[model samples]
Each structure stands twice: as structure tokens, then as C-alpha cells.
Target: MTARKEEAGPSGLASALVASGALRSDWLTTFNAVPRGMFVPDRIWPGIADGTRQNPVVDRVRDPVAWLRAVYSDIPLTTQWDDGSHSGDGLGQTPSSSSSQPHMVFSMLADLDVTDGNRVLEIGTGTGWNAGLLAHRLGGGNVVSIEFDPDVAEQAGENQRNAGLCPLVIVGDGRLGYAEGAPYDRVIATCSVGEVPRAWVAQTLAGGLIVAPWGTLYGGEAIVRLTVDGGTASGRFTRSSAFMRLRQQRPDLPRHDVYLKGREWPADGIGSTTTLSPAEVGGWLEQFAIGLQMPGAFWTVERYDDGTYTLWTYSTDTLSWASADHEPGADAFHVVQSGPRRLWDETEAAYAWWDGQGRPGFDRFGLTVDSDGERAWLDSPDHPVRCTDP
Candidate 1:
């Protein structure tokens, strides 16, 4: 390993996470064994930024430093696009694959309770970072990772080979899990699932643990940990994470014209009155509430010569949201208000509720999943059920 990567080893970051109570002492070897830099290419954004994702450009034969930093950093790197509509040959807006952030992967693994000799099956073979960690910890033969995108799968295979950590890397829809490797000690998904695939639960050995990111109707994402009981599995939200929306479940981009047409004023006591940017507020909703409330506003952030800012949210349902500079005020933006759902009201109310809760996140939300589906409660097992969605 290079000197720079050596400096970022599990010793420092692992110590920090342990001090913060995010990780334990025993898993340090997994961190050391898998040099994250080897999996990532050089010159990429550490996290998603701007109006889209942060791109990590790789030139295997050139710019080794850039590659090393991205590889070693605990951040995820986007790898694929449009679920094959775009090619992994280059980078673009659509991110179909990624090497998930190290801290997040570590956190998820800690939650999985992976022990020595554990037979593990991982979903989403993105950049193969998680698979590397698993293989390092539990011998190559004990690890199996599946990816849906064929090109991505091939690339990940190459990365795994380069890292000299080999496992059963397969290109297949993860929704089915790896039936041939059923009864796994642990099944973890690096990708997000709109719903807990029933096949995963059935395939897990009774008492085995399944960790996955579950998408909710409320707009937020939660890491759910389920332990198979009888034929059912039950667990709760361990944390909050955002993954590129699933291929089959990606929301249909609403009609721009239809949304614009509904931009109007108050009708039947329902109108847009808030001076908050709906985009910021809505994204916040995913973090604050269980995602039951979705911000119905949108905006284009503009900076003025006077150092002022302008933000707006327009919808075809006649409900428009706008905000300006200063402590959350907007300029002479537009508002067309009319909708059965009262988009602004729902958004504001959810925001208010989030504030009331003091902005709890994965630290507060607990999950319990079984054959019946999944439920989101608070931190304590006895806490009030917050979300029960499929």
C-alpha cells in the first residue's frame, strides 16, 4: 500500500468510529484487509453533489494518486448508469453502480454481526468494496456477491481480481438472492430495495440476519436488520442512507408541463404560503420524518450580484412553493395553488412534525421485518410504530 493510503488505515478512522460508538474493536482487521483505494478509480467526487452525483473518473494507467484517495476514502463512488441504458464505459448523470462509502459499509457490516467463518451473500456488487471486506474477513469461499448490471458485474469482477480477493461474484438480479447459496449466515444488500424482497427472507437460514436499505412511501430510506424467526424475519431501522433509486422502482420523472401548469394561487383555502425552498425542505423531509411527507415544491437556486438568492417551487396542481435569501425568505417567485393533496400543507406539516421530534434519524427509527412485510418504530422496541409499509 502507498504511504497516503497507509495513513488512512483502519487504525485512525476505526478508532474514531469506535470512540463515537459507531464500530467495535474486533472488525478492524476487515478494515485493514480491504484497501478501499484499490476498488475506486482516480478523480471522483467523494459524495453526490451539485444537481446530480459526483463523478469519479478513472485512468488506471495514469493519475494513481487521485485513484488512491478515492479508493481509500470511506465514500461511495458511482460506477454505472441508467441500468444499462447508459454504459459503464464512461461517467454521466445516471449512476447505476458505485463503491459505497467505507463508513457506511463498515456500519452496515457491524450491524450484520458478521463473525469468522460466516457464510455471507451480498447484494449489489457495485465496485466490490463490501465484497472485498467480507471476503477478507470470512475467507473467499464464504462470500458471494451478486450484481444485476452485466457490464458492472464484469467490471467488479476485474476489480476483485485486481485486489486479489476472490469470491463467487455473479451477475444476476439480487431480488432473488442467491438461491444456490441459501441458508446463508448473513445476507446484506448494498443497494436500496423499494420493498423487502420476499425471496431474501425465505432464503435466509432461520436465525440468520439480513441487512438491507428499504425505501419507504414517506420518502426516507432506512437500513433494516431482520433476524429470521421460524419462517419470518423481524428487525428495525439501524440508520438512514440514500442509495441510487432501484432500477425497476425509480420514480417516473413527473411531466414538466403538467407540473408547471398547476402552478397557481390559493383555491379552497389551500395555497402555497411558505417562503421555504421546496427542494431543500423536501429532501430534508426524507431525513426528518419517516418520509410520510414529501415536499411538493421545486426550485432553481440563483445567486444575485447583490449576494442575494432566489428559489421557487412550481407545480401543475396549482400549488407553487417559493423562498428567497436571508433566513429562508425568497424573492417575487410564483405560486399556483390547487391540489387535492394540498402538497404545501402536507410538506409543512411534516416539516413541523420533524422539528417537533428534534430531528431524529436512524438513531431513532427501529425496524421489524417478517413475512408479513416491514414496520418502522422508534429506537426502543416498544416505541410507537411510525411506518408500516410494503
Candidate 2:
């Protein structure tokens, strides 16, 4: 255990959250009762406000002040890296689990819109902070949290017990909703998913809400709040998010060598020049729109020392690939595309379409999940985005 800092306590954090409008009056009691520090482990990698980058480790035993400060801060704290396979003081290859940012946590809970006697099913227990909040608001028996990792579930259970909150922390795949606790009034996912699982809809009662971070395999992510209605669920995105992808839904992307297939740069690939700046398409909203339009594609950037980078886009099938060389202040970017699919052409077309459509932000977009599968629409379910490959 670490000594608490005077400025880095639950009261200060609660006040900050309330001032930010993240902590509503109804949920304030739970927020204050179940402190984030109680749920967080002694050691953690503190993430930035944007949730893109993470700082070095801060262990309570070595640096309690830093640890407490991180806990109370609005940013996220990465608790486990590389699915717990990583060890040491330095950062890991990937951040597997984390105590999500406070603003995001409370905002998502607010989107959940749960009431007294409402049963909640939480996906991804993580540090049990979210579950503890839910358990405190709605009785412990009314909250059920599913965790894919046994170790994480164990630790979350321990945290909940220590916090005097006992929400059922089940060790199971979150994609498969806990049917034993069927027909929950509210469902929330801490982790993001490319597609809304059918089980979640089936497990939710009619008119119940499912709030989650829904994103694309490409890059951009946003929090979507869907309302279940019979067999179909539809709702608009609430805010932008960058949560870890659900474990089962994580894509197995093809390597660069596999795309090249023993060939060198621009080997038998059609080359062209475009006025579309690669930098313009790299923005969060641009990526979201492009990802929605181009379903099976994803992108990466290869940076050079001269302040330029090559933007590479690849299809999930590993057969199609495109590269656009982006130099600073270059009017025309060089493009190369191979495979049967004209990836660069398609991406450019998608961006143009989005631009023509007023480049709508996340709030204007909505998702619908039903028997036919999921489709993202602009405003209503009638005007769905034309997905190249669904």
C-alpha cells in the first residue's frame, strides 16, 4: 500500500469529474464510494489524455506519489501489457488492459442510463472500477461483469471484494454474452469491437441500451449507444474513443513482406500521382469515415527522417495493397497500388464521397445491427453507407 497524497485523493478527483460534467449528481455517490485507486494495481503505465501514448511505469512501492497522482488524474492507467506476457519497467508492445480514463468512464456510464432495479451486464471487467461503480449504483446482484482473462478476472474480483462490492466477475469470452444473466436492462463494453456481437443484442431486453466503443479494423474508434428493439439494434455514436479492441475481434493483419510477395517497391504495381494529401486522410474523423466506407481495408504509416512518410493501406485478405508517399508541402502525392483491387483509387473515392457529404462527424453517424448484419448509416437506417465488402 502507498501513502495517499493530499491533493491526489478521491475527493479532489470527484470534484474535478463533477466540474468536467462527467460525474452526474445521481452517480456522484457511487463515484465517491468506489474510488479508482482502490481498483488500480500498485504498478501501472500512465496513459495520456488522448489515450494514444503511454508513459513509463509508476510503481506504488517505489513512487507512491506518482502512482496516486496517476490514479486521480483524468487520463487512463495501463495495468497490463501484451496480454500479461510483457515484463519489466519499460513500455510493452501493446497495452492489453487498463483502467480507462475517468471522463470516458463516467460519460459512458451516463450514456448507459441505468435506473434503480436495473440489471447491468458489463463486458471487460479490467480493474473492476467500472463494475464497482455499477454495483454501488445498482445492487451488486444486479451487475454482472465478464472478463476474458482469468488472471484479470481474479484480480478484479479481489478488488471488488476489498472495495466491499461483489458484482459477479465471470471468467469467459465477452463476445458471448453471459446468458445465465439474461435480459439485462443495460449492457456496456469497456473494450472496443469492429462489429457488435449478436449475442449482446439477444441478451438485452427490448428498449434496453448497449453502449460501447465501436470502431473499425483500420484505425478510428467511437462510442456508439444502440437501443435494442426486438431483433434489431440501432443508435447514434455518442463520442470518439480509442479503447483496446476486444480480444476475440482483434484482426490478424498481413505483414508488409506478405503484401510485397518477394517483389520490390512498385513491382508490377500501377503508379500515379494524386492531389489528395495523405496527411488530410490521416485525421481521426477522416479515418472514421474512410474506415466505414472501406470495410475490409486498414492503413499504417512508415515515417522517414526527412519529415515525410509512406501511407500503406492493405486489405484484410492480404491480396490488395496501396502506398501513397506523403512529403510535406507536396501538391501531388505519389501513389502505387497492386492486386485485383484498386485500393488507392477506392480510398480516394471514399474520401471524396465523405467530403461531398459534408464530412459528417461521429454524432451524425449511427450503427444498426440486425439479422442481416451490421451497417453504419449517416442519419437514419434508411440511408446506409455503401460498404464495398460486408
Model 1 Cα shift for residue 184 (angstroms): 2.0
lDDT of each prediction vs. the true structure? 0.65, 0.91
Best by lDDT: 2
Tens-digit per-residue lDDT, 1-390, candidate 2: 996654877888888889999999999988878989899999898874222454878999999988989899988888998899977877777789999999999999999999999999999999999999999999899999999999999999999999999899899999999999998999999999999999999999999999999998767899999999999999999999999889999888888888998989987789999999999999888899888888789988999999999999998888889999999998999999999788888889889989999989999999999999999999888999886762
Q: What would the per-residue lDDT of candidate 1 be over residues 127-229, giving only the tens digit for each residue? A: 7878987888888999999887877778778888898889899988788888887779899988787677777888888889999887654356778888887
- TM-score of each model, in listed order: 0.77, 0.96
RMSD of each: 5.2, 3.3
lDDT of 2 at 384: 92
Can you tell me which runs of candidate 1 are displaced by over 4 Å?
1-24, 41-45, 49-60, 84-91, 260-290, 293-336, 379-390
Least accurate 10 contiguous residues by lDDT in model 1: 263-272
